[model samples]
Target: MKSNKATIHDIAAKLNITASTVSRALNDNPRISDETKKKVLKVAKQINYQPNHIASALRSGKSRLIGVIVPTANRNFFSSVIRGIEDHANILNYKIIISQSYDEYAKEVLNTEALINARVDGIIASLGKMTENFDHFHKVLDKGIPLVLFDRTADVLDVSHVILDDHLGAYQAVDHLIKNGCRRIVHFTSAQRINIYRERKRGYEDALKANGLEVDPALILYSNMQLEDGRRLTEETLQNKVHFDGIFSSSDYAAMGALQVLKENGIAVPGQVKLVGFGNEPFTSFSDPTITTVDQRSISMGKITAEMFFEILNNKGAELISKKTIIKPELIIRDSSK
Candidate 1:
């Protein structure tokens, strides 16, 4: 059976010109005269001709496609980042391929391999929480592909990245609680080796010491920092009779869980126990007492991350110097802390 789909040769034959000329005209090459391009385009529309991107990519050695790997697309932060990347990519006549790692190391490795095999022009990713080894990302660099890491990044990989000042954000949150007379403030954090968590923990400790308070090991609770984890940890703290006047959680979901546990136990927020959370998730504003939180400026972070990726890509990986862009976090005080 013969396919009826029109090709450049069909348009060339109709215009009494060479197939190469039709191809150049379709691509808007300056070498092709405007009159010839007009004729080729008119016939192309009549025949419903569609350009094959794969064949064009093979000829140019450029796919005009970018690969994006995120831990999870369920979060607003990662989605916003992808939007920023897509918007900029569209302007450059490029398309994006997105993959999710779900914070799993093995999945992240598979995504990296898949993107590389797809022959993407570049890759943008955020390191997964369980990713200890960076050999997969290293492979990308070795293959001479542009790689950019945003948010959760690794120190071992010498790639460009954009992130928030997690330490400063934590410090401000803890310090704000201290200023409001929270003496025994409990800090909720994750035990992951990711730099963000470590920085937040450090900020919490530094804030306590700076306020003439001793760093009590009992006051620091480490967990996965999920909603259930926060609820369980808070319940255990109350049951164990741990005395605390405030709680600072590195995650908004965890903070909400703490709030729910406090309400269930008849504890009053701000009056008895002040509370603060990070990540300014949408629910923070909707929750009863409206949780106080640190805004990560996710939209700005996304745009900056995309811009950085393009900068490195335009440089064609010739300059491998590690560049870091740190965005400032904003503290949003609400009923929970007031």
Candidate 2:
């Protein structure tokens, strides 16, 4: 036969064996004799025969492929999670394709649609900010593909998820500052639409109430939570003569900005203005004064998220589908807050 591609039929033709027998032998079905299997393998090696995975998958109705979505590909938290997911997925002989939403609502929807069109066996994702509409996520469920969310997840979605306890993390952070003698604390957060930040803000408020401190409406500030915003807000608070002994920022980047401003203004961290930041990013450990923050256990969250997807995938028809996993956040004490 005039053919450029090598296939199992070519091996069978050379060995003068039935194609079905050759297939069984190639797969080590145990029905084939060892000697015959050895012979089949030898000829198969000579021809460099490769099994057609596409055809096999089509027959079994499984792509053995997973789709993953995150807010940003370059972020430390998302990258760490990707490593965990990759390690676990590789062991099961499955490949994953990843997409980033850059924390945009529209892009996340588009990415979800693209993954669905690609026909992945399952999906794992972290929701982006401003993603109130979840019809695209529903599309995945309608197609019967396994879906799991991690980190910034949707409360309304009834699928597998692995997430950090944001409320407790924030509560502990504020409580620690209070214990250290911070009375008037300022909170810097992102938009209220995002769930994690919202939860963290709530925790901040609850911690204040629990510590017998009145919730000051003027102290809770919302911004983009960027570096410049952090610095600007700190300066603005000072200019406005807002009396605050502590500041809890929702992001490390913002906290760093605030730290710089505090230093320039002769404010001593953990002495004059105790600062606590969320996200134990790498920079948090090496800053001028190490930052006290919440460790979300992102890598472990990733592994568990993938595990949840596989659990549902492996148990396709079973009713044990919708599962939720909450990863506890640990408080890391450092000079900034201690």
Clash tally, candidates in order: 0, 0
Clashing pairs in 2: none
Return the top candidate by lDDT.
Answer: 1
Among all candidates shown, the one with the greatest TM-score: 1
TM-scores vs. true structure, each candidate? 0.91, 0.86
lDDT of 1 at 176: 97
lDDT of all predictions: 0.91, 0.88
Report how far residue 242 has shifted in candidate 2, in Å.
Answer: 1.8
Which tens-of-lDDT digit does each residue in 57-96 have in candidate 2? 5665876789999988887788999989999999998888
lDDT for 50 (candidate 2) = 79
What CA RMSD would you report for each candidate? Answer: 2.4, 3.4
